[model samples]
Target: MANTAVRVRLTRGASEGDVAALKAWLERERKLEALRSSGELEIQERAGTQDGQGQARPMGAGLDIMLVLIGAAAPKLFDEVYEQVKSGVRAWRENRRDVENGEPPEVEVAPDGDGR
Candidate 1:
């Protein structure tokens, strides 16, 4: 009978579309998981539908925040965010590999021709 919301602002390294889509996906995953864990998601919504339509779903499906790129930032804003996330994930994996190999955990990412 209740709902919740989570607002997140990536202070750096996130584009408008990335933030929007990520926020929406995260919110739904969190909500649905919470509802299922709490035993709140009923499965009868499609039972009475005449042609596959069903009861209303919970929460709106879109970003609530404005996603305006920083006008003063460099023109390759989208690429920057993509590379940053990719590099971060790579570094995290490298660190884990280092740890598993009985070595010190180290994090570093080299650019693949795109500025990072």
Candidate 2:
């Protein structure tokens, strides 16, 4: 079976702790069991250097994650994954005063299209 993947990248708006929390939640949260058991969903973390941050931001890679959906997934599945991730991050940022501001860090999620 072929596998499609989506990369979820976060900016400095998310702290190291936040990244760890998100990874843990997505991996172990009971709420996500349905998605986990579907055989259509899989998650992974990748490590790499953060390039092009310029002078304003730091230059280092954060703990970014990827979501892999097996087989030919429907468009709605993408939305479902996006929402799940956003919800997870939102929950993590809720109580934190520093990141609870009007504008939180940016989360960019996009499909790589290369079914491995």
Candidate 3:
């Protein structure tokens, strides 16, 4: 079957617990089991990059969490998964002081090209 990847970029870095919560949520999505079984469903965290000066930086820190999906059904299933993941991220961000004014995290869903 054909496969595609959906990249979910969050507005802030996600903690390990947050990633686990998202993983659990995705695991419970039984309707997407086929994709999971085929090894198409995946979630990952992208850490912030360091500056050229070797100092710690938060550039693109917002584009932290990423979700990868594979399989021919991925296209049709993207919206549902994106919504669920975004909801989860928002909830996760609410309690973090790093989140601006405690506002819900913004999420951007896009195609994961190059499969990195």
Candidate 4:
């Protein structure tokens, strides 16, 4: 089975707290747990930003999240989970009065080392 990596770039208006809550939700997500048990999912999180001087700053309003999956069925699994998560994120953002209307987070799938 091949391994695939999926990267999710959060929307610009998402606060650090939003990212934290999303991370926590993913941790306790039942679907993710099932994927973990089946040996098909691995998750990594990247929060904060780089300063103009190239310094790593503290957590901020935007973050990136990565997920690695293994198995022949990984692509399909990623799609399913991504849709569910994206929907949840949209709902979460809608409830927040601080965020402005704009493009939502984007998910990119990397297959064979080329991100598309």
Candidate 5:
């Protein structure tokens, strides 16, 4: 069985931005298409996390597509691939100036009240 992208989020140590970057890179690199054709793109199986919120982005790697399970992959691994995605994203934005991506807010980050 070939290695396919599994729907897993990066672990606590993983960087969300990094993972995103990798996906963008693969898309532009044309790796995503190849993975899809090879049946390696759509076979992600994310692992568990401790933050209790590791299921937002799909995190995985291979071929044409990139997966980030919001929050379930290892941080180190996620960062590594994310850099690739970032590169791709840069390439795409540079080529298509008019294109704009507005990602909706998924998480609500609010700090607890601490009156000093």
Candidate 6:
């Protein structure tokens, strides 16, 4: 693996609340929690600026659940994390009544670039 960090993000046709719920759901995974506790994974929220106050706020369209791989063990741990995340997304999607209304949920794994 490259020396740089790898970022994995999950996105779905969601409302802001849905994004938050998905994040919470993923956090409940035992393996993910353990990896986080060990500093091998990092979770981040993607938000947009509020119109007037310039404050960061979650947006539904592009809101994503991002995992950053930062530790030396990340290569080995990557599969475990990916599987857990996939399971979480699957569970989340199964509970949505409008699962067929828009694009399906997806996970993207890419090089950690400029934090975007």
Please write out the lDDT profile of model 2 over residues 1-116, one tens digit for every residue: 22256666677666666566667766664545567787777777775345234233465346567776665663457666666776776665564445455544565655555534
Instruction: Arrange candidates, best TM-score first.
Output: 6, 2, 4, 3, 5, 1
lDDT of 5 by residue, 2-95 (tens): 2222332233233445345434445446654454455433322223332335344344221122243122333333343444445555554454
Off by over 4 Å in 4: 1-3, 47-62, 94-116
TM-score of 3: 0.48
TM-score for candidate 2: 0.62
Off by over 4 Å in 3: 1-3, 10-38, 47-63, 97-116
The per-residue C-alpha lDDT of model 2 at residue 98 equals: 57
Cα lDDT for residue 5, candidate 4: 59
List the global CA lDDT of all models. Answer: 0.31, 0.61, 0.53, 0.56, 0.35, 0.60
Better of 1 and 2 by lDDT: 2
Q: Which stretches of candidate 1 lie over 4 Å from their true place?
A: 1-76, 101-116
Q: Cα miss at 103, model 2 (Å)?
A: 10
Give the top-scoring candidate (lDDT).
2
lDDT of 3 at 51: 35
Write down the lDDT that model 5 would get: 0.35
Q: Per-prediction RMSD in angstroms?
A: 19.0, 4.9, 6.3, 6.2, 13.5, 6.5
Distance from true location, Cα of 56 in model 6, Å: 19
Candidates sorted by lDDT, best first? 2, 6, 4, 3, 5, 1
In model 5, the Cα lDDT at residue 50 comes to 26
Using TM-score as the measure, the top candidate is 6
